[model samples]
Target: MDGRKPTLKSSQKVSLLSSSVRTVIRLRRTTQVLKKGLPSRDSPSKVLQRQQSLGKVKAGNQASFQGSQYFTFDTSAQPPQSIKKKKKRPKNPRVLYPGCSRKYLPTEHKSKAKRCLLLLVGIICFQILNAIENLDDNVMKYELDGLEKTMRREVFGQALAVENVMGLLKDYLATHIHNKPLVISFHGPSGVGKSHIGWLLAKHFRSIIGHEMVLHYFTQHHCPEGVPAMSCQLELSKMVTEMVTQAEVEEKIPLFILDEVESMSPDLLDTLGGFFHTNQTNEFLNAIYVLISNFGAKEVTDVLLQNVTMDLLEAQRTTEHLRTILSPVLSQIHPLWTSAEIVPFVLLEKSHVRSCFYEEMMSEGIYPDPNHIERLVSQLGYYTKGELELAITGCKPVVGKVNLL
Candidate 1:
C-alpha cells in the first residue's frame, strides 16, 4: 500500500495539470459539442455525460467556482426541479389620451422613449417626451390656460388723498436708496387703517415682488394685551438684515413689512443709530423695506408719554418728535429694526372708503351691514388720509363689529 501511494499521487498530479491546460481550449470544444451533441435545455445531465465520456472531469470549474466534482447524475433517479413563476409587469389600460399634462403619470409603457443623458456616464433617463398630441380631441388641455391671467386690484375701501401717496411710493420704490433712507410714516389710532396702507403699498405694483411682514402683535414681541411686551428692536434689526441676506442668496425680490412701529418696545426704539448699508455680497439688503405703525399718528399719545417722553403732546406733533425721542434709544434696535422712520403709504378718505366698500362688496356679491361699514369707516377719523383709504378698500362680509379701542 505504501509503494502504490506514489503511483496514486503521480496519477492525480497529471490529471490536475492536464485539466488546467484543457480549460484554455474548453471554449473551442464547447462550441463543437454544442453543435453536434447538445441536448435540450432540460437534459443538462446528458450534456455532462457526453463531456465526461470525452475524458473531461466535468467537475468544479474555478472560473464559475466549479471545484473538482462532476455530478455523476443518475438519469433514472433524477429528481424534479420546481419552476418558479416570474412576476409579470402589468399591462397598459387602453385610454383615449388626446392631450398631455405635465403633472400626469401615464399608465402606458411604450418601447420607444426619450432619453436624457446628463453627465456622459452612458446612463440615460427615459421618459415619453410628448403624449396626447392632439389638443382638439381633449378637454384637459385647458388646465393651465388661465394661469398667466392678470389679477384685478381689489381696491375696496375709499380713495381719499391716496393718489399722490401711491405715486410717491411707486417713485420711491422705483428709485433705490443706499445709506440715506427717507422716513415716511403713517400714524393713526387703533383700528385705524395703518396696516391696510402697508398692504396697499405692498401690492401697489401687483406686488410682483413678495412682501415680508414683521408684525409686532403676531410675533409676540408686542402683545395685544397692553403689556409693554419685550422690546426686540435689536433683534428685529438683525432679523431685517438677515432677511435681506437670505433674499439676496435665494435671488428672491422680497419686501420687508414691519407693523406697529410706535409700539416697538421702548428699549429698541431708543437705539436709532442702527445702519443697514453694507458692501459685502451677503451683507446688504436687496429688498423694498416698509415699516408701519400706529404710534406715528397723534392718537397713540399714551405710548409717547410712557416710553418716548413726559410731555406727550410734543411727541405727537410730527414724525420729527417720534424720531427725536427715539434718538437716544437707537442703539438698542440694531442690528434689527434700524434707525429709519417708518415708511408711510397713501392715505384714505371718507368718500373713498364708502366707494371702495360699495364696489368691492358688489364685485364679490357680498353685502355687509351698511351701518357696520359706516361705523368702521368712522374710525378713519383717527387715521391719516392714506390709511383710511386702505381701511375701506373693502370690509370683509364676516358678521362682526371690529372694536378698535
Candidate 2:
C-alpha cells in the first residue's frame, strides 16, 4: 500500500459508512433517480409555461401574512360579469276602502260609521263564531266588529300572493256556472286580497242596491266550528254552504266566500267544487259561489312550502315567482274558473309603508323615537302597510290614504 490511502473492498466500504452517511447516500441516489424520471426540460413551450406560471406570482401579492402567497392575475384581460338588475318595486297607492289609509288614524272609521259596518261585520262574526264552535259571540262580535278595511285587505293580499291562484280561480269558475259557474276559487296565501276584495266587492255591491245582494261572505278564520285546527274542515264547509244557502234564499244570491282555501283539504276543494256546480242539482240553492284559497298548483310539485305570510305589497313583487310555483294549483282548478279579478292584496311595501305611513306618523308624533318606531313596525315583517296601519290605528287603509303618486 502507498502512503496516500488504503483501498477496501466494496462490501467493506459500504459497511464503513455510518447510518447518517448511508441516509445521505441514499437521498443522493433518489435525487438522481427522480431527475431521470422528470419530464424533459428542453421543451420550450413547457419551459415557457413554467416561467409564465412563476411570473404570475409575487411575494407582494398576498391576502394576509397567515395565508400562503397568491398569484396576481390580469383581471383587466376579461371584463367583469354584469350583475342582473333587480326589479323596481311599485309604490303604495291609495286604498279605496275606509281604514285602508293611514290618514284616518286619529279618526278611525268605527267612530264614523260603526253602526253601518256593524251589520256587515256581524254577518262575518256570526259565521266565524259558528265555525269555531261558538268560540264566543261576545268576543267574536267585538273582534270582528273591530276589523277595519285594511286588515281584510292585508289578509286577502297575502292570500292572493300565493302561487297558481289565478289558474285555480279559472278552474273553479269553469266547473261551477253553466258547467262553468260564476262561482270560482280565489286561492292565495292568507291575508291576500281574496277575502279583502270579496269584502270590498261585497261592500261596494252593498253600497249599491243590486239585484244580487252581497249577502254571504264566508272566510276561513270565521269557522263557526273550530275549523282552523284542520280537524274540523268538513264541518266548516257544511256550515259555510248552509250559511250561503240561507243568504241566497233570504237576502240575495248565495255569494259564498270560501275564505282561506289554503286551510282546506283536497276533499274539501273537490266537494266545494262539486256543490258549487251542482247547487243547480238541488234546484233549491243556486248560489253564486266564490272559493278562496292560498294554495297554488306549484306548491304541490316542490317540496318547499312558502307560508301565507307576505303582506299586500310583497304579493306584487313575488307574484311572478309565486305563479311559477302555483302552476299545479292552477291545474287543480278548471280553466274557466279564473278569479273575477286578480287584484294585488296589499299595494304597499316597505318603501311604501315608510312613505305612506311613517311620514304621517312623524307628522302626528304617534310615537317617540323614529328609528325605534320603524323597528317595532317591522317586527312581524310579513304583514303589509295596510295590515300594520290597521293594527296601529285600528282603522282600514284605503288607496286614497297612501296614494302612490
For residue 365, what is the lDDT in candidate 1? 60
lDDT of 1: 0.44
Instruction: Tell me, by TM-score, which candidate is best.
Output: 1
Indicate the worst ten consecutive residues by lDDT in candidate 2. Answer: 389-398
Off by over 4 Å in 2: 1-179, 187-195, 205-252, 278-287, 297-325, 330-348, 355-373, 378-405
Q: Give me candidate 2's TM-score against the actual structure.
A: 0.34
Task: Quantify all predictions' global Cα lDDT against the true fold.
Answer: 0.44, 0.46
- Top candidate, metric lDDT: 2
Please give the RMSD of candidate 1 to the true structure. 31.2
